[model samples]
Target chain A: MTLTTTLIAGLVLGGTYALVAMGLTLQYGIARIMNLAYGDMIITAAFAAFVVQALPSMNPLTGLAIVVPGGFIFGYLVYVFLLSPLVKRAPDKATLEVDSILTTFGLLFVIQGVLLVLFGSNYTSYTFLNVPVSIFGTTVAANRLIALVLALTIGLMFYALLTRTRWGTALRAVAVSPQSAKLVGINTDRAAAVAFAMGTALAAAGGTVISMYQTFTATGGVVFTMKALIVVIMGGVGNLLGALTAGLVLGIVETTVSTYLDPGLTLAATYTIFLAVLLWRPEGLFGRRV
Target chain B: MLTLDALSVRYGKHIALDNVHLRVDPGETVVILGANGAGKSSLLKAISGLVTPEPGVSITLDGHELAGVAPHRIPDEGIALVPEGRGIFTALTVDENLALGAYSRRARAGEARQRDFIFDLFPRLAERRKQIAGTMSGGEQQMVAIGRALMSNPRLLMLDEPSLGLAPVVVGELFDALGRIGASGVALLLVEQNVTISLELAARGYLLEVGRVVGEGSAAELKEDPAVRQAFLGLNA
Candidate 1:
């Protein structure tokens, strides 16, 4: 019964991780940016939800009405104003990689600082759904189940868009080879901007879901970004389905390790798994090791 | 018609094309023959807007200047380049590659007809439509490249060394396809080291040596010129 409960917890955690990791994959794989600022976008959304929840008789989910489109436009502006110019002027591929990392790293701190200034470094959350529901002889948090369901639904929607839409086809092609994409008459800048918007919008949605269950601080962005990056690397750089599966696997491992061993060692276990995967399967579980 | 007036390109200090002038009228096939390092590829790159030409170099397609236009915009203006080594999106399926080729609004409008025409022209592509482009043989990839360019409904089709790494039989078939493309009223600008096949397909030709145009004439005149025979035809003149 304990194992069943743990597994349920793992599944919920996995869903959240999948949501976050998908966003990182889009930013890194499609836009070709490491996007250290990715978690900052999440933090921003979390704060936005917190503010909305603090308002009289307001639901934090309503924050999505603001964060989703706001995050996309913010990301689009960042790509258009900050990243694209650097990409355009980059002398070579290696330079673009390094420059993007450094630039996003700088942006990460700027966003974190702005959030700290505005929100005063408080650990806050929205406590709307704390009810427990029984499932197969174990009780699971209803809020967590809701998060998992929402995540899975959104993931499916995202997958359909990627596989079934013309924009999705163009995005995939641009992700693989921008030069070929351009030759095929794709406006690569617009493709990249859209990639950034989609990625950041997903980040915002994931953060909103997270705010419902966890007390999060401004500095929480770093740890979240690191975890999402691990999931992305373990899955495959550009494979979304790989990210979903990898996220589930990670959540299970983390939960199991915390349940069996010391809770403090969970972070260590996560790093160990990452290192093992890197040594054994550097191309990731779903990627063809190039 | 496509015209290049005093077109020049440079990579830092290394000059690739120097004050070269060339033109191709509608439905005409023009070939540029040159030795290795003779700026042949650079000439194509300049016209395709892949590289920015030096100041005062003017490229016009149907009297519209294309010198500073972005590479993606060139295809929209009815020009397509089958780059050297066949720049097919290797990971994409053959069908996806062709679909992407018809990406411009004008091309998209007629994509179905163009796709049918391509399938008729290269039946192998139709058969392997679902196959990944990278897994195909080199000659087949060349066909995909040519077919992809055709899908764009280009008024000017530029080819850079289409015969490279191809078997003689495949090369013959490729040139035959080029001949058919030229006969279909699309202007052809071919840059090749294969003088014999190119001369056979092209109506007119130019010899580029060290970034400069050294000779220009009808294909028949170039085939018999002592300099062309000595340098390109492997004949003692």
Candidate 2:
């Protein structure tokens, strides 16, 4: 029964990780920028939720509704102000990637600084739909179940948009080659902006889900970002389905080890698996080896 | 009609295209022939907005200035370029590649008709619609590249070195497709190192040497020009 409960909890956690990783994947795929500040976007949304829940009968979910759109606008602004100039000035792809990493690395510190000024280093946690339900003789939190459903729904919607819609097709084209996308009449700048917005919005959603159960500080964003990076590396950068699978596997392994062995060694065990995967399949499980 | 007056491109101190002037009337096939580093590709790049031209250069297509227009807006202005190296998205399937070609709002509305027209032109594309573009042979990839450009319903199509690195039979097949494209009333601006086949396809030809148009004439005149024959066609004195 304990094993089953741990597995269920792991799955719930994995679903939210998938959401965060999906945003990272989309941003990297379209813009070819490994946005190191991705986790800050999520924490920003979480903090936004914290501020909004001060009102009577307000909840983190309500803050999510507000923050999601704000996340989109913020992401767009970031592209326009920060990323576009880098792209314009970049002499080559390798330079763009390097510059973007350095830029986002700086952005990470900026966001963390702002959050620290506003919220301090104290850990904050919020709750919503805290009801517990029984599943196959194992108890599960209703909020986590809801989170799983919501994350999976969002993932499916994203998949359909990428594979079905014209905008999605243009985004994929831009991802492959912005130059070719331009020849086909695609505004690559617009595509990149939209991709950033969508990615940040996903990060916001994942942050909201995390806010429901996890305690976070202003400096906590990097931890989440690092976890998502592990997932991305294991899944293959830009492979959405791969992210989902890798997230779940990571969650399961981490939870299983923590439950059966020492909780303190969870990260160590996780890193071991990550290193093993890196040694065996560096291109990721789903990625085509370039 | 497309007209380029005083078009120039410079990479710092090096002039890639120096004050070059050229024209392509409606439905006309024009080819620029030159050896490596002769600015033939740069001329097409300048017109396509891929490479920004220097000040005082004017490029007008049907009386609208193409100079300084955004690269993406060029297709909406009825111009499409099949860039060097086929430029097809190798990861995408053939059908997806063609679909993306019709991405502009103007082309999107007529996607069905354009797709059908392309399929009719290359039935092989229809047969291999679901295949990943990268897995295909070079000849097939080139066909996809051209078909993708056609899907935009471009008034003027530009190609850079379409014959580069293809088998003789494949080159023959590609040239046949080029003839069909010409017949469809789309104006063509081609840059080629393949002098013989290009001259046969184009109504007029320009010889570019170190970013300058050193020679210009009708196809027959260029074919008979002793200098062109000696330099490009390898004809002995």
Candidate 3:
């Protein structure tokens, strides 16, 4: 029974991680932007969901209809107005990586500042569907179960879209080789913009679902960002299936550690795995060696 | 028809192409022959908008000025380039690479027909459509590149060193495929190091020496020229 409870909890956490990391992969892998502001975007979406929930007869899930598209538009505008100039000025990918890191680092602080001013940096959460339900002889919170289902559904949908559609294939082509993408008549800049937007949309969806089950503060975005980044690296940068599998592994490890040993050692366990992976397989678990 | 006038490309202080003028009419095959550093690649790059030519240069294809067009837009303008190193999406499958080749608006109408034609031209590609392109042999990768370019339904196809690192037998098979593509009414602008097979494939030829066109003639004239025989064909004058 205890094992089942831990596994279920871990899966819920892993689902959120997988969804968020998928977005980061798209931004970094396809758009070539090491977006330091990614977590802040999630926090912003969480806040948006919070506000929507405050309205009469509304919930976080309903907020997704607005927040997801809102995130996409915001991502598009950010890429065009903030990042495209850097892309144009940078002579190569290495230069662009450095430039985007510096730029989005500044953007991180700016977004955090705005969220703090707006929400006052206090841990904020709302109650909606906090009822518990039994699953295979273990009781779990209904909202968390909903979040898990949503995350898995959306993540798998994105995976299918990437593998099955022409536009998605073009995006993957750009991720694989931007120079070759142009030879096939794909406007790489446009593809990058779309990819960045899609990434933020995923982020927004993850955040909204997370808001349904977790406490989030205006300044708490960095923690989510770091977790997603770890998942992405563990899975192999730009490898979607890798990210999904790594996220579940990390979640299960953290939960198993917390349940079996000391709860405070969960973070330590996460770092131990991260360091081990980095030392042994720097290309990531699934990534091909460069 | 394609025409280039006074096209010059500079790489920092180095001149890769110097006021080079060239032409290729519709359904024609022209080859540029030059030793290393003779600016053959630069000329093709300029035509495909991969590199910018100097101001006042003119590159027109079928009455469309393409000198300053964006590289991505060049494909929509009915030009395709199989760059050095094949430039195929190595991570993608052969089928995906060909699918992307028909991404341009002009190629959408005839995508199925073009794929059929490419498979007929290089049956190896049809056999390995599901294989990842990078894992393929050099000859097969070059076929994917050429097939992908053909998927664009290009009026003028430009190739830069398509046979750079292939085996001798593979090079022969590759040129045979190129001959079939040329015979199918697509204009080819080729830069080749192999003078013998290129002379046999091309109708006209130009000799580029140090970024300038030093000689231009029919393939027969170039093959018979004593300088060409000595410099390219490796025969005593």
**Top DockQ model:** 3
Give the worst 10-residue stretch by lDDT in candidate 2 chain B.
B102-111
- On residues B83-102, what C-alpha lDDT tens digit does candidate 3 reach at each position? 99888888789999999999
The best candidate by lDDT is 3
Clashing pairs in 3: none
Clashes of each: 0, 0, 0
Model 2 lDDT per residue over B1-36, tens place: 999999889989999888899999999999998889
The digit string of per-residue lDDT tens for model 1 on B1-237 reads 888999889999999899999999999999999999999999998877778899998899889999999888888999998998888877678887888898877688889988998888899999999998889999999999999889999988999999999999999999988888888888999999999999999999999999999999999999998989999888988
TM-score, candidate 1, first chain: 0.95
Docking class of 1: medium
How good is model 1 by TM-score?
Answer: 0.94
- As for DockQ, the candidate ahead, 1 or 3, is 3
For candidate 1, give the lDDT of residue B37: 96
**Listed models, DockQ each:** 0.50, 0.63, 0.67
- The lDDT values for all models are 0.87, 0.87, 0.92
Which of candidates 1 and 2 is the stronger one according to DockQ? Answer: 2
